[model samples]
Target: MRIFLYSLFLLFSIVSHADGERVNIASFSQNDINSWQTKIFSGETHYAFSTMDGRTALHANSTASASGLFRKVSIELSQTPILHWSWKVDNVLTGADERTRAGDDYPARVYVVFSGGAAFWRTRAISYVWSSKQAVNSHWRNPFTANSQMVAVQSGSERVGQWVDERRDVLADYRRIFGKEPGKLDAVAIMTDTDNTGASASAWYGDIWFGAK
Candidate 1:
């Protein structure tokens, strides 16, 4: 009987491990923003906790501003490779060409950064953006830097004012975008900016998490 019980325990452990684990990056529902830091480029984009769709979320309002909230956390891509999040935009920008620096603005974007450490120039990033003009699933190099790439996860005004859930295989995206294996993920950031186009934008972000496939 003892041996049988031990075997049953082992089987349960294996099954639980196979189910994988989740790492929470943001818990806006619980009003948690303890570890996030703000980085401003042009001007500050106002961020606040607000109730939306019967749940709490982070709301960003940008008017000719460039700013983002970032959290530094090391994530092992081999373990938790999938990123999950939900967002909603009030409207997509008008007359903004995402392919040029002069029009590099987004109403909503969630990005992952891989640190280059001492060699800062080697740092790379992948931004999943809600584009105004680009087609969904299309990707391009950021006009500001080749080190960063942009993927249009959501596009256009067709889905405006509605919450959209997104999931991405970060490991696969990194391999495809950089043509190489990625190291540990250094940080995650979210931004809603219209500084370049000198326009205004608003967005709401739900909780974000990383999980194993």
Candidate 2:
């Protein structure tokens, strides 16, 4: 739409780094790549998992919450950073927890915990795809907020179904939601379990990295 085009237009072409370097820490390793993230769930192939055509995730008939995140990079709690990525939903089913909560998300989500330290555990949901009920009428909305009642993660755009980049400042995002500065960003986690009901669901992730501007 005109909005996305405007976003592309208004978006800063100026590199955050004057030296023209990308600010990435750790990320998903395909070949001999490694970083500092820990495994919350090591995924395996099963009924919930299907290898059709070469895609990887914890979908129905796949394993447990084994969605992986590597290059477990950390962003300094200051210097307002941006987290960017290109992604979209492939499918949606039910979930592990069973009973739907605010999200009503079946084939649940893969969340990232952005705690100040290992002891803190505040998370950002990767989000859900359009259900037969909800049309893709809603485009992307920055600063999506979620709570106990329902989730406000739906954006308005569906095309650019291409490799679109989404950038978010970790500091500003956390402060807006939690209402304060953060501590030490411990580790980033990728969780693909189910709803609290435990029906079995998941999401997919590609190269994920965090850095400064």
Clashes of each: 0, 35
Give the per-residue Cα lDDT of candidate 2 at 27. Answer: 35
TM-score of 2: 0.49
lDDT of 2 by residue, 62-157 (tens): 333333332333445464355554343444442222123323333322233343222212333223232323443222222223311112232333
Per-candidate TM-scores read: 0.90, 0.49
Model 1 quality (TM-score): 0.90
Worst 10 residues of 1 by lDDT: 1-10
* Model 1 residue 34 distance off true place after TM-score fit, in angstroms: 0.5
Clashing pairs in 1: none
Best model per lDDT: 1
lDDT of 2 at 202: 35
